[model samples]
Structure formats: structure tokens, C-alpha cells
Target: MIVLALCLVDEARCWAAGESVRSVVDENALEGTPAALWDVDGAGDPTIQGFATDISINRGETVRFKVTTDASAFRVEIYRVGYYRGAGARKVADIGEAETFAVRQPECLKQAETGLVDCGNWQVSASWDVPARSRSGVYVARIIRSDTSGASHIMFVVRDDDGGSGILLQTSDTTWQAYNDYGGNSLYEGEPAGRAYKVSYNRPLIVRGSEYRRTSFWANEYPMIRWLEANGYDVSYLSGVDTARRGHLIRRHKLFVSSGHDEYWSGDQRDNVEAARDAGVNLAFFSGNSVFWKTRWEPSIDASGREYRTLVCYKETHAGEKIDPSPLATGTWRDPRFSPPNDSARPENALKGTIYVANCCRFDAVTVSADQAKARFWRNTGLDTLSRSQSVLVGLRTVGFEWDSDLDNGSRPAGLVRLSSTRLDVEAALRDFGSNYGSDTVTHNVTLFRHKSGSLVFAAGTTLWGWALDATHDDPDKQSAPTDLRLQQATVNLLADMSLFPASPNGALVVTQAPPDTVPPVASIRSPRTLEDHMFHLPVSVSGSATDQGGVPAGIEVSVDGGANWHPANGVSDWSYTFTPDRRSFVSILARAVDDSGNLQPVPTSVTIKVSGFARLIYAGLVGLVLGCGALLLAFVARRRRLLAKRRMMGL
Candidate 1:
């Protein structure tokens, strides 16, 4: 078993003094508005809804908000979301009530052709000149009507582009806009073609009803913010737009976290994150259905023509009627069938170690077998105590709402480990989302893999992994899921392993010591073990088992041509490969393995057997044919002899 021991006090003490910027920011005892008062759900309609001019702005940069409401004036209350003494958010700045700060905005312009609601025509109702010393975080602008009749929220990020935080959390604002049908058009629906190929970011996001919180901030992101801040992780927040444009900021951090329903992603964003991961920055995908859609940025279709304000994704697979007209075809990232010129064939499984599989949301349990519970990440989580008969440990409501599965696509990362396997029957819930993967069953897997650069990538293949960490976050389905302490402790272990120690008081935790994995894994051929096993047919099948005591097996490679060319097998621990013999000669099969720590198998297990069945069958068929021809000739000769004897006897 992997060792999990107490971390050195000196090392812990060194980091103990290095408190995260978020921890320091939370130390300021600021007043916070209660959810009952701040949330617009109980107040009134969504008439006061609005959106920011930019998704994120640096300190000292001004972010403008355009509001269209029935109220004569509205208030823009800026609140930074964090664990501010359990208040969840602290009011940073409040601008409103006065004529200078709040004004009645003009009506939004809508495009009849594309069904796009362009609010860029509306006048700026409020502006916030962010302070130079303001902390970087996800800030919400609560637009409350002057009469207190209605209220709504506009979200933006305050970015500290220079500071180097331990963890950078990228909010799924792109997905929020995709599901936002504010002005009768979102990426998912609202057009003559059934959905808008292009979605503008200038309009309010999901301001229709309570469902706004469902896909927006509170859905899958807020819980992470609360839990990360509560644990005092040195975390910073940025929007997907920032990652696309100012991606150099990502390389500065030690860890990058893609959280929530982060489905839509630009090519630039994927490249930047992959570059960071390759550079040894640890990656944690606390998300599901991430990087599934391939989208691009465009200028707003308004008088100003501001850049990067529109998210364009044709969603060609879902529409199935027409492909994107642009050279840069917008569709699923994994699909290479884009209309020439440009295509994003990069499947998300390559980066995330898993890809989205399920179409509907179901609160399934993340079940880990007894063997997997022994991994260092699951140490002290009360899972290691599972009995042999009670082989699985379950985390309820951890897997939900469009989860992902492991794909054996050649792009899978080496040494990928599955921490949990939860299978679901999605026949009734199946909907084609570009990928024509029609299957009644899809297995949701929480995976971890070690990159060649020694950086670790962990994917909690479900969207609701955060729900088990914090129960107060808003759920779209309004399903009550209690907090699971085991999942929380596992998160702590994972974070600690990444070198970001918890600044807050967590229960007794163990950190695995760093050591070189020198021991290579052992591979054995389980099938076709002997000549008797290979005597059945010309086409042969080989199977094997591998064991890695130091770590999990990365992958298995099999060679059918006498170890000349090796190819990957489907699975690691238990693997199978099939090949047909080209000649009626002796054939050899060799199998080898490599561990996640880059330890290659010193010796490959080989099984050589003579494949003479084809040759024997051909020889026997030829012999039978010659014998039949001889018998026919003999019968003809006998008949001729009988006729000749009869003729001679008759004295003809």
C-alpha cells in the first residue's frame, strides 16, 4: 500500500506562514448582506436584470453595467463572494439611489434574423472604478430596483493579473451564457433553426426566473468558492474569457482548477490550460462536461462592435441540419468532421482524462472498491476500513447532472487511475449533443493521472462533486443532498498533496512523503499460455494481468510481431489484444507494462505458439481432392473395361 504519513513540521510551518491572498482578504471583518435580503427570488420579478460590459477587469479598471428595467432607478451592490465568516459574500461597494450612479436605461435591440438580443445599445446605468488594492475574486452586482420591487444579479471577476496564487479557479461563465435564454435566445435554444448559433454576452444571463441560479454562479461554482475559502486555500478566481485572452496569468499559478459546468471552451483556452499542465502546474477538474464544445469569440453585433463579447458555437451536431458556415467550424471539440479548413479534433478526454457521457442529471453515488480506497488520496477517509464482502464505499449525490466517462481513445493520458466507478442507465435521458454516442449505459469515473512532467491531473468526473462538500449551494433541481465528510476529507488530501496546505482547522490529515518509484511493474500473459491454448484457430487472442506495487499501472502494450511493434491495449490491470496470423507459421505474442511513475517493465512476458491449423487444413483439402479425382478416374476406367469385355464376348 502507498504510505501516508505525517508531514514534516518544518515544511508545514514554512507554508503555515505563507497564508494565501484569499485568506488575508477574508480576514477583513466586513459586513455582508443576508441571502434573504440580497437574493431576488423572494423580492420580485427579473425586470431589474443586467450584465457587465466585460466578464473580468483588472484592478483600477472600470466595469460598466447596462440595465433595462421598469424601475426609474436601480442600485448596483458589488459583493465579493468568499467565506467571510460564513456569510458567503461580503459587500465590497454599493452604488445607487443617486441620479449620477443609477439611471433609466434604453431598450435593448434584438436581431430578427439570428434572434440575438443585443443590449449593447443600452446606456451604461452604473460603473464601478475598482480599487487598485482590491482582491481578485468573483463579484456579483446585485441590481435592486429603487422601489425594492425587484432585483437581479450581474456577475464579473476582479483580476489580480500579477499576483501568483497557489490555485486559480476558472468560473464557467461561458456555460452560464450558453444556457441563458434571457432575451429569447441562448446557444441551446431560440431561433428558426431551433437554437441560436451565435450567443451575445451583452444581455442579462438567465434572468427569467429561479433557474438563473441553477446554471449561473450558485449551481456548481459557489460551493467551491465557499469550501476553498473556508479551508483557506490560496485560491484566485478568473472567468473563461480571461483564460482565453490573458492566459499567461495561468502559467504563474502552481495549480489551475476548472470548476462547475464548464462545457464551452475556446481553442485558446484549451491550449493555455494544457500548456500550464505540461509546465508542471497541477490540474484539478472539479467539473464535468468540460471542454465538450468548441466555440470562438466574436465582436458584438451592435454599433460599438466590441470584440470578444459574443460566443459563437454552431452546435452543428445537435442541429444536424447545417454545418457552421465559418472556416472555423463550431461543434464538439472531439469531432474532426468539421467542414474542412478548420476542425477541433481534440477530445476532452485527453486533457481531463475523461469525457462527458451522460445526458441527464441523476444523483448517483460515487462508489469506490476496497482496493481503490487504499490509494493515498483516500487515506483516513474511513473507506480503507471496508471489509472484503462490503467491497464498495459510496458517496451519495456526488455524481450528478451530466457526468463524464473514461474513453479508451488513443488520446488518453498514460497512468490514468480510476478512483470511483458509478454506472448509470441513460436510455430515457439520452439526447444527442453533437457526439452520436448512443448507449443505454455510461459509467461515470473519477480519475487521476500523473503527467510525464510529474504534474498530477485529477478529474471528479461528475458536476456535483462540490455538492458533497457544501450543502448550502443552490441546486437547479432543488434536491437536498447532505454533506459527505469522506468526500470533504478526500478533497483535503488531494489539495494537501498538491502542496497547498489547509490554513483552516481540518481534522487529522496525512500527507504522503515524496519518494522515487524505482520498482517496475510485473506483467503476465493470462491467456494463450501454452501451445495447447493456441491450437484452436488461425486468428488468436491474447490477454494479460499487470501488478504495480509502487503505484498503479499506467498502461499495457502488446506486441504480436515478435516484439517488433507494440500497441496499447484497452485496459491496464486486465488487458486484451487480438490479431490474425498472416502466415501459417509460428507466431509470438509479448506483453509489457509501465507504471504511473514512469517505471517500465524490465522484462516482457511472451508466449510463442505454432499456428499450423491453416496449413494443415489446406493440405488435408488438397489430399481429399486428389483422392476423389483418382476414384472418379477408376470408376470411368472400370465402366469402359466392362463395355469392352461385353463387346468382345458378343463377337462384334
Candidate 2:
């Protein structure tokens, strides 16, 4: 068990210690060999592609478009999609016969999963500044290349100053960035063009579904967007950018929705929601792995340095993190190694109350948790009082891509209710993960829990939760996830329940804004400050803190493996982490402090860890032994299942 701890002077002593966000270093160490080939596909149309200088641009704010095209001239048309009395999109701006600027495809420093490329540096098309009377919705740029007679469009969110009334749809543009195959590279594509460590949002997006729609707008985001828009749900549009940039705006809405495949997140994003939750804003995690990654935002300033137009995220690992204020290793949100030991590594499970189990994407029947088979959450699904969890609820495939579960090692929300789950068949190759992991019968959890502030956090637990509503993914021949009636009804119930109650404060007698803290707090290691010739199997103690100055520490975290992550330490009395190294080599350790007044350590304390190579070899041999034993056990289980099946066939 990895026990990461954070030690802070009792609040009364240190004005409360300061906050700390350590760069993360543990879990999802991202180990598959990167795609070995370059995927800079210079083919396709002579496209005029670009991105909105800002995805969540407020009305009246100047919005610019950067276009890169192989062709010399093209027409750029901007349209707004909403309930314009059923007219669909109303053309807002039309720049005709414009000269296409230079289109350069700069290579990325890493590899992506999908066969896409990255066009990091492209030329601008034209700036489409919004007028004072513009409405809040999704806007598109229709660019027509005159040379090749090809067309492409870009999607952006026109945000209202206060994010209009009712539900706030936070689009999963981060997921779009991950899947973007434009210029042949994305977070999920091949190398030489893939920006794995740091992805810049300075390029055009040409692969969001189709010309008539956004890439994942069809598969993930737009399906729900259109549903809410068509049904007149009093919804407002904003990208994940808004959540990361101006999370305070969440107060304007009663319901905050996390829409489709929202796998990535920044520390600020999580903090905003937690604050909102305590302040009584209902949260709807409509997507799986909702607060999965501890991400950080970067300003994409122009060459003049006078304008900031783009966004950046160096996930898991990056070389240029020395200048960042909250430089978290962009990867999975759990594990102490990524975060600082002083912070006790605030895993995704802390807020979401669930842990991602494994990577998946295939047909699986949906069912209720054994305890929630007849819970009120399922009252609208016609499964009340007489339902058995063994029975299929959706009658079709509902699980896919990724799934989450309640971790046995961690604590769930005080009153969390397990609503849904599916027994998954994982591979035996992941024996290192644990005994129950990488097997054919692990259960994933869907949960609901209410905070003391009278707010609720609901997790769908499946990446393809939207598929249960509509499966017509902008394609006629290509099928989508099954959209069953049961799932739709349940979704409706969820939406209704989310809005049924308003968030109420925890009733703190005195609540006020934390004072501005211009001065950063100091930090240092609390345990194992120095080590030499350490064996990989020998457990080590990790802990640290940040001076609160006059206020209490808002948080404390630590990073054990260099500066890959800054995990928030979790402990009520005292904080410290217990860790064991599995690999040989010298790793860097660091910790920081963040004051309640919002000041963090400008420079953290560091520790250089030295582990003997012999110890590493021993650890590797032990892990290999475990894997070998697990594989043999899997074979035995398979044989037993086969024998049972044969007996049943003989009517025995």
C-alpha cells in the first residue's frame, strides 16, 4: 500500500499552512512503445483550417481566426447554431475571396495514438470580433478552398458573460484535442508530429466529425448539445477552457454538466468544482473519467507577446515545466508518485468518489449495483422494488472505451451510493496492477453521493454514456453505440434529478473570500530527506508541507518521481506517504506549500533519490514471478469454465 502523507501545523498555529500542488509521478506511467512512424499526411484537400483565437470567447470580446491553406484564396463564413426558430445555423460573418496565408506543419516532440498530425504553427485567416448583441452558443467557421473546391469548418463556443441561466454545458474540447487528427497528429496519434508531452492549441482542427459538424461533436459532445438545445433546456455553451480559465462563472448556473469523453483536467478545474460543490452548485459528470488527469494551462501568446490566443498542456511529462506555477504531470489523476507526498496525492477518487478501473471499449450489458437495484435513482427506469442486478437493464451494449470503479483501498464519499456497474473481463497481462485486475470478471462502479452542502456528485462510469441516448453518430452505414429506451429514460431521470434540488451551503457561520497572497509559501521534505544505495523493494517514507503564513494551508502535495506530477496529500490529522520503488535509477523528489490566501511555494524543496541497481533487478524478478503465477491461474480458470460449459451442454 502506498501511503503518501502531508504534515501541516494545526490550522491555529500557522494561520493555516499554504496550498501545495506537486508535479505528479505515479500511475499510468504511459508505457506502450510510441508509434514508430511519422504520420504527417500532407494529403487530403487543400484545406483552409484554423482555430478560434479562443474557444470560450465571451460576447463582445474580439475573436480571431487563423487559417492555413495550400490554396491561395478561400472564403471564410461564420455561423451560429442554436434555436434560431428552427432555421439551424444563421450566417453571422462572411469574408469572401480572401487570400489564404502560409500553411506550415511543424512537427511535434512526441507520438500520438491515432494516425493524425499536428500543425503547431499556421497563418491567420481573419479576426471575427463579436458584437455586443451576440448570443451564446456554438459558432463555426466555414472555409471554402477555391483551388481544390474543398471545404472545412472550425468550432468555437461563444460564452455569455454569466453563462446564461439554467444548465451549463462544459464541452469536452480537451477530448477533441486528444483525438484531433488534423495535420496528422493529436494526443492519440503517431510521432514526429504528435505533441504528447505538450500539446498547443494554436493550430486548426480539421477532423471534428465532418464539415457539417464538429469532429467529436457527433460522437461525444454535440449529440447531447443538440438534445438539450432542441428540447429547450435553457442551456448555455462553454468549452472546457471556460472551466479552466473562469471557473467562478460556474456560480451563474444551477447545474454544471461535464459533457462527453472529458478525460483531461487541470488542478484549477478540480478546485473550482470542489469549491462550487461546497457553495451548493449541483454537478453532473455526464462522462467517465470526468476529473481524471491533473492538467495545467499555458498561455499561447503571439510573437509580439501582446496577445494570448492559444492553450497548452504537457501531459504526464514535459521538459519546460520549470517555469510553470502549478506544473502537474499531465496524466492519470491517481497515485502518490505523481503528486507530492506532503499532499497525500489527491486521487480522482477524492472528488468523483470513484477510480478508473481499466481501458475498455466493447459491448457489455448494463445493470444496477446489487445494493442499488431498487434505489430511488432508478425509480424512473421501471426497475423499482422488483429488480435484480443480475438482469440486464439496457438490453444492449453500454460499456465502452473506459470505465470507473470504487477503489477498495480508498474511502468513498460519506454517503455514496453505488448505482450501476458491469463485470468486466480484463486481460491477465496486468497482474502487476493487482489480483483482481486484468481479469474477465471485474466490476466497474457508477455512483451518486451528496455533499454536506446539499449538493450531489453523480458519475456515469462509462465513456459512452451518451451512446445510451442517441447512436446516430452522423453516419448512415457506420453504427453507433446502441441507444436504448431504458437508457434514455434513465438519462432523463438523471437530468431531472440533477436540477430537482438547489445547492445549499454547509452553513459555515462565517464565510469570506480568501485574501490575495502575492507572496509564495516555503516547503521542504518531512521524511527521508536524504538516501543512498536504497533497494527498490524497501519501503520509504515521504512527506512535506507549505507555510501558511497567516492563513491555513489550502492544500499540500508531493512528487516522488522527479517532477512528473504533484499529487494532493489526503489526511485529516497528519500527512505522509509510504512508497516502494519498483524500478532502478535516480529519481527526483519535491514538495510545495499553498497558503489559504492562495499563495504557493515559488520554488519547492528537492531530494535526489539514489536506488541501487541490484534492488531494482530483484523487484523486477518478483513482478515477473507474480505475472507468471497469474497467467497460470488464468489458464486454470479458463479450463474450469470450459468444463462447466461442456457439462451444461450435456444437460448435466
Candidate 3:
């Protein structure tokens, strides 16, 4: 005979065991439901051991079963198919009696309602009361009846109370799974490999997996999570979240974290995340490659009658048909649909010092020693150079990612940490300290710019994070050991300054004065007329260039009388304006610049078009007869003069 006992556990890990079995009905499982029969006799004969079929139960209730076999010494068991691979089954109960045996239910099956039914030989029931703290999704229960002879497995699923609270993590379908393993394809473990080239370049990574299964666990250790938690942030660890519900989920969190090599995303996911950002929900791209690919999800059921999820992308595959002209590429896939002509425009680098660095670049943390501050400016000639040697890489070299060439250069006051390069013993000192990768032989200078946003964005740069490690040391020599501390400190200062802005209750705007050389000088009309009527038609033509140090000439004002009044010019170009001069009066034209700061530079000196009555009559008369005759005579005379000059000069 087979004897079985059951144990139960509460949400707090407390446990209890039971002896007797009770029959519980599942409301979802009514009469006429298919049931399986088990043979308890060891004589190899198949006997239809009858058990209760199709029972119903309400939510938050448990059902147990007591099975009595007709055979005196036969062992009977129950088994349920699985919903998906890796999902185990639950053992409802086991029985052992004179000609019949009794089995009891386990406690783990009591808290939630699972939709399993009893097939007489064994009993099946559901657990409906899930704890409030549990994240939402489909939970599963497995019942196994085991003895010395063999074991049978049964499966059931429970729907959670709040089913869509988790974040969906995804990866590029084109990316090779081989790279999914750390130390594979030059990627560390837990880091999803991203497409090597930009989207415009057309080498997007493909997807390989269930559409509904958007998340992948690449790198186990997500540093951003630790950082957020350390700073008292609330976070939930979840797998795939429903695409439709993502927008709502994002609203609940102040910050959304894409941790550990998140390289791919569906159109809906990207749009939802971007919308959240636009709504003021901050995003921390803790991973390297993010939102690089597009994918689609398809729903199906697994062997265990639970929902099966599959995702599709545009890569050549043997089993499934390829998504032609991939929805990601063609912009037609639904749900996470992204507009076609996939926007290759990168996010604005407006966050101040945040910058994207190329791979394989060596970064050192050098401190600004007291002695090094005497220099007016510094340029890294070599310490770290870009691996690709691409001109675009120049923009990535900075103390923090936030530096802008046009805005930050020479904008900060002196004593603000500056970067400099020297062919001195810095590398040798580092070598002595056991650093091997970089050495004195390194030829190129490392170009570093001070971050202007202060430190908030600077701290976002991963290099500064490493530098911060060295800054915390107590000993002066050890503190200054990295030699990049000055650059790092300058970065920290930038972040600190930015923190003040966000933390302040009053939303005060910050402004800095323009450099002296950047200021525009004032000018006015000194020539042919006043400031009025210079109108013309669409094809009208005029010519003149404005001059300004910082501002660009946006428009020109024309006046017929000196300074009495003025009218705006027709068309404006870089420092130049073109329009027809006033026909009724002598016209004077003035041009000025409009800076980005909305400040207008002084108008340039005006050009005067002097019109006289007699002159106008003379001009009209000369237009055809005198002008044609004068042009022909001038050409003849010029040709003759050129012939004579050539003969004389060349002795021809």
C-alpha cells in the first residue's frame, strides 16, 4: 500500500503537516471534464481505478482528496501535464488503506487558487489567496505521487492578484545567444550583446525566443540596482511584463532602470519608456547596449495548458518564417510599433557632461595635485586614445560626459579643474604601482574636457565612478595615487552643482555671462539713406553681410529716410540679407544678429541707395540704347587692349 502525508507553510515560512484527506472542488472544473485513470496493481494489469472527476471550488479555498483503491496491495498515483518546460508539477495527495488509501493536501497549495481537478485515484484543487506583497503573474503548483516503484507528476496554475507589475527585459533578436554567456563574444556574463553598428548602418541584432518572453538574464550583478537601493530607492525585480501595461507601471516609479546589458526592445516598450521620460520619470541606462532592436510577441499555449509566449524579430531562422522587411526596419509591426524611417537621431547630449565613449579606451583617474594648478590650460596628448581612431570619438573625451566644445570651452573661471597632458613619469608611476595595461610608450594624448553641468551628470559617467573609488582613500599619497583625481574631482564638482538645481524648491533659472570676446559690438547706418520701405517680390534680389562676434544676423531693416523709421528685410542667410531696394525713395539697409540667448546685437552700418529724379531719367534712358552701345564698345576696346598688351608683354 502507498501512504502519503502533506505539509503546509505560511507566507512567513511557518510550517504545518496534515494526516487526513478532504475533497475540495474547483468551480472552473465542472462535470464532463476529461479525467485520467491510474492502475494500482503491480501485476502489470491496467485497472480503471475510479476517482472523483470535475470538482468546483471558489477562490481562496483549498480542496483535498482521499483515494481508496479496491486492490489490497496495489499502489496508485496521479500525474498532470506541464504548461511549459522547467515548470514543475504539484502532488495533491497520496493514499494507503485496506483495499483503499487516503492522501492529504500540502500547505504550500493553500494560499493561492490553482485550477487542478481530481481524477478519483488522486485529488486536485486550487489555492486562491495569494499574499498582498507578491508580484503579479501566473503561479504554478506541482503535485507528485512517489514511491519505491516510480513517480507521477501533475501540474496546475494560479493567477496572481496584481498581474502586471514587473518590468519586461528584452534583448536584440539578431544578437547571438553565444554572447549571452559572460566571457562569450567579449561580453561579460549577464550583459546582453547589442548590435555592433547604428540602426542607420543596417546591422540590427535579431531576436530569438518567445515574443512574450521579453526579458533575458544576462549579467547577474546589476550595479545600478545596488546604487539605487543604497540611495533609498524602491525597485521591483520582475521578468516579462505585459506590453499594454508598461505605461502604467512606469508611472508608479520615479526612475526606470535598464540594468545589465539591455540591448533590445519592442516598439511599444521603447515608446512607453520614452513617454515616461517625457513625463518626468527619470531613466538610468545602467546597461551598455539599450533599445537597439525591435521585436514582436505572439501568444500560444504550452503543453501544460498555460499561456506560451514567443517573440519574433528579423533574422534568418530555420524553424520560423523571417519577418520580411522587418517591422523594425519597415515600421509596420503592431503593438510596440515604432514609426518607420526609424529615427536614427540620437538622444540630445543636452544633459551636460554625459557622453558615450567608444570601446577599449583606457581611462585613468589622475588627481590635480597642488603643483599642477599653475597651468592656464591642459590637454591630454596621450594617456587615453580612442580605439577606432575615428574623428567622432573626439567628442567622447571629457572629464564627464557633459562637456560641450562650443559652450564649455573657456566658460569656467580659472582654478576650475582643467585637463593637461605631459610626457612625464605619470605612466611610470602607475606602472610602479602595478598597473600594466597603460605605460610610458602610450603615444597619443588623452583629450579631457571639464564637465559644465556640475557633477550630477558627471557621476553618471562610468569612468568617474571608478575614480570615486580612489577619492575615498584617507592617505594623501594614496588619495592622489590614481593621478586622475583632479579630472575626477572636476567631474564631481559639476555633478554637485547640478544637484543643487534639482533639489532646490524654487525653480530658479541659472545663467552665466558670455565671454568678453563673444559679446557683439553695436553699429548703425553710416551711408546711403534712412530706415524704411525696401519691399520686393518673391524673386527679388539684394546683397549684404552682417557682422557679429557671437550672434547670427537674423534679419535686416531698411529705411528710406535716415533714422526716422525702419522695415525688416525679406530673406536672411548666415550674416547676409538680400532684397530689392525701395523704388520710391533713397533706401538705407541695417542688419543685426539674434543670439541664442535672445539678445540682439547692434545693427551693422547701413548701405544707402541714393535715388534722384534726373538720375532716374538718365538710368531709364541708358537701360537699352546707351547701355548696349556702351557694353559693345567697351568689349571691342577691351579685346583690342588685351591683344596689344599680350603682344607687348609676350613679344608675340
Candidate 4:
């Protein structure tokens, strides 16, 4: 008999009033097949493979699938990924014995310049009208050839837009599209110029068990899903695109979670997430290499003008913006030197607390320092009895492939604390995949901090942190680690601390949310107290400090000429900016700030200073003449000394 260890609430309380999470997992628990049966195996140009028309769909909405197959006919079996006893998924629908659901698709379209493969031209093979009562979670459609034994899977999410769950888990579908090299090339590799700058989501994610499955759902997110459901946590699901377009739904939840390998993000997605954080929504990033690449969404070539069907990333760090067709910078988020000029010059670390530093392929174990193991989050984890000899808490290989670090790069969140530290030897691991630092050793950290909005943000800072949560997850092949109870307990402790927990053993899950941050930050100029100044021919230094009810201000910006063009200041809270006016005149220096909750300072602190044009020109001429005369004198002296040395060598 298998024993359920975590918070498996009584079956009678599963359908408790105001609690939808428990009913979804407990009602009609379908007997699922073994893991080997559901997963596609032995693939080489799969005879049957397909992709969903959209990454996800809302309840009562229909989702279509585009399939390309060599088989005469095929069928689709839909399964909602979750935990049912030891089974990982529950069969939700079966579409077979239907002529319209057979494999019928046109040849995939390709763009020569970008090497973009668009399967949007293909006809929809099958469509599913999601029932209103269907649970919100990750769903997979297993396509099986009726004539042969070929089979593959297409995955998508079912979002509960109205369900006010405590947590909302956003899938890393954009990252999946980045690595999906289906027709010809992905964002990583191809023909015309090494890698494709743009990748279309309309094509099928290649049916490789070891590559696609490991990089996304199976290896990273599925495990976390199973663990959450098995432990009876109140959670709903959504896709990255949903976060961009329907981000207002995020405010309904008490917590927001970004799960596993969430690398690429559009500007809208980042803005919505940061806004949610400022609105007092707790954020838990169980991911790595997240928000690293700046991306934008574009419509497909189809007549429907399907927006967000294509993902574009130029990787300007290596190829520069010459190849980028979009007006916005499609490069790394940390780099601000785009030709068109990026307004928000902040890095991913500004919101994530930790920034991604190293590349993938390392399976390092997380080690909590003796001093840090005593934190409240580590309660009941047996770490309080941790002895000096029992240091290496082995088997929790949560840090791996690509990871993040708490590098003091100025954008780090205030009051950030490192809960776990693990030094990884990446000299060999990162030889093939490049790292930002290129150091022999890099440290990985799990970080947590309290935002001024009274919301807590926790970052696992690793890609495989979910791998330690459930045993039914996809293995990392050679580097697979066993699931431990200690990490599970820690997760439970974290949720409880965030004001989300089961009210009683047989009661509904309760969530206590704080009021949203609505007050704007106050900005004041701290330097050049004398508002009027006549400092001609000298650089003007402007500095200020800002106070926000939401904790530290997001950042400060300064404008020299009546706010026509503003540039980001050097720092937040206490900030500074120095500039020399092109022409000496009366210039109004304006300083403004934005808080962590996305509250902008309405009125800017202004200081008017006069730069005398006459003095500026006179100083310029005198400086130029003095520099020119000094250069000519030095040249003459050097020439004379050289001639004298030559004469001495020849005659004396």
C-alpha cells in the first residue's frame, strides 16, 4: 500500500464551499496509465506529431490542433496532468472514431530570411470545446496513429480566469517555443545566419522524449503540479501569453508563480508581473534563466491576424540589432544599448531578486549555510538538529542546467536574503554553453525578500527545484536526484507563511490578502539646495532621494530640459545624475521616481539653473588653446631630444 505523506485532506471536504482546487483533484479520480505508456518513445521523424493552435484556452472556449502525419488516420486522447494517487494524469476526453479528427494538414510554410517555420497554413485536424466544469491545469493531447503504432503528444493549459485561487502558475511556453526546432530552425540554430531570429508558435514542438519533454513540461513543471495537487494547494494555471494579454487576472490571485526555464518575456508580460507584485501579490519564481531574453509577439501570416503566434528574439548580445526587424530591442533584458533606445533600462534582477549568471548542464545540490538553516522557512525540516558533520544535505539536486546568483549589480531588491548557497564547478559544465561571468566557480542562491507592499517574493534560483517535489516527474537522465521530504516540508512551511493554508484538516483552504498599494512615491531633490544657480562652463550634478509606502522605489529618472527627454538615474531611493548642457542656457532639471508597485511620481522636483553662454565659450577657447599649445611644446621638446640623442650616438 502506498501512503500519502503530505496534506491529503479528507475526501469529504474536497468539495467544500468556496474551494475549487480540492474538488478538481478528488472528484472522479480517473485511473491513469503508467508513465511509460503516456509518454512518446523511440522517435525519428515521428509518423504522428501535432501541435495546439494556441498555448492555452479559457473555459467554454474551443482549442484547435494542427497535425502532420504519414499515417492513414489518427485519434486524440486528452488528459489533464495532475496527481491521482500515484498516477500523474487523469483522462478528461477521448476523440476517436471521427472522420474529421483524422490527420489532414498542408505543407508547413517557411520564411527564407528568418528561417521561420509556420504551420499556421495547416488545416485544423481536431478541436475541443473545453467544458465549463473542466479543471484549470496543464492538459496534454496524445495523438496516436490508428494504422500504425506511432504516437506523440501536444500540450496546452486550461485557464480558470474566474477562479480566485491563492496561486496562479504561469507555464514557460515561450521558452518551449525558443528551443523548438521543428521545420528547419529554432531561435538557437538554423541556415541563413546560424540561428533564427524569430520562431513561430504555430509549428509542432519536435516529439523528442529527451529534448522537448525534458526542457519543459515533464522535467520541470509537471512534478510541481503533482506535488501541489497531492498536497492540496489552491492553485490555477495559465500560459505566458495569458499573462501578457489577460494580466489583470493576476490581481485576483494572492500569489503568482513562474515555473521552470522561463527565459523569454515580452515587455507587457514583465510590466503586468511587476504590477501584480506592487499590488501585494506574492511572487514565487521556481525557475532559472527566467526573463533573460527580451522578446515581442507578432501576428502570423494567416488571414486571421492571430496575434502572439510568433516569438521574436534577435539575441543582440551576439548578433546585434541589425538583424532585428522589430522597433523594440529583441536582445538580453540586462543590456540597454539598443539603437532605438530602450526606455526601461532595468535588468531582470530588478524584480527577480536574483539574476541569471551561468549556463546549463550542472546538477549541483543546494546547501543551506549553518547560519541560514535556522530561518523560519526551515522549520520542521530537521535542520535545527543539523550537526557540523551532517553538512551536505545530499539528494536535492535543485540547482542545475542554468541557474541564478545574487550578484550586487545595483538592481538587486532591498532586504534580500540568501536562504541557501551552493558553489558549483562550472568550468567543464559551461564549456559548451557559455556563462555570463565565465568563472571557474559560480554560486547559486535561493533568495527571499519582502516588498514594500507587504508581499513576499521567493525565488528558487534554479531550473530543477521542482524535480525535488514529486517522484512521478520526468527524470533529468544521468543527473536525476531523488525527491526528499525535507524540501516538501519546506514548501508547505512557505505556503503557510504566505497566509495561505488549509483552515483545518477537513476545512477549505484559506488565503488572507493585504490591500493593494495605491499611493505614489514622493521624490525630492537632495543636492543643489539653491534652486537658482549660475554655474557656467561646469557640469551640473543632480541628486535626490525618494520615499515610497511600498518599500524601495523602483527607480528614479532625471530630465534636464523641462522633461522633453528623461534618462534613468544611477540608483534608486538615493539617486544621482550628472549632465553638461550642450549650449549654455537656462535649463530646468527635473527629477521623478516610480515605486516598486508601478506607482509613478505625478509631480517632479524641478530646479532651474543658468549656464552663462559667454563664460562657457570663453572657457572652451582658453581650454582648447592651452591644450593645443601644450601639445605643440611637448612635440617640439621630444623632437629636439631625439635629434640630440642621435648626434651623441654617432659622433661622441
Candidate order by TM-score, highest to lowest?
1, 4, 2, 3
In order of appearance, the predictions have TM-scores of: 0.83, 0.61, 0.32, 0.73
lDDT per residue for candidate 4 within 1-652, as digits (tens), equals: 0111111332223222223343544532446556666666533237777788899998769989888887777888787787766678766677784833565577787888877788888878888878765679898888888877577888899998878888889999999888888886888788557889788889777624435456766778778877777666677899999999999999999999987789999989999999999999999998988988888888887666699998888877666445686678777778766636545556777888888877767777788755456555665677767753345463366787778887666577654656677887785432221223454777788877668787888888888888877766656456777887767766666777677763222122223333455677777888766545655656878888988784346557677878766666765667788988777677888887765444567788887777677666678789999999999999999999999999999995
Give the clashing pairs for model 1: 415-554
Model 2 residue 395 lDDT score: 33
Candidate 4 segments exceeding 4 Å error: 1-22, 27-30, 42-45, 99-104, 210-213, 339-342, 386-395, 428-437, 502-652
**Cα misplacement distance, residue 596 of candidate 2 (Å):** 35
Q: Which stretches of candidate 3 lie over 4 Å from their true place?
A: 1-130, 134-221, 237-245, 300-308, 315-326, 330-652
lDDT of each: 0.75, 0.56, 0.28, 0.74
Native-to-model Cα distance after best TM-score fit, residue 353 in candidate 2, in Å:
2.8
Report lDDT (Cα) of residue 227, candidate 2: 47
lDDT of 3 at 213: 18
Best by lDDT: 1
Worst 10 residues of 3 by lDDT: 196-205
RMSD, each candidate, Å? 8.3, 20.7, 20.5, 11.0
Per-candidate count of clashing residue pairs (backbone under 3 Å): 1, 76, 91, 4
Q: Which regions of candidate 2 fall more than 4 Å away from where they truly are?
A: 1-46, 81-93, 98-122, 181-185, 188-195, 206-215, 301-327, 341-344, 369-373, 385-390, 428-440, 474-482, 500-652
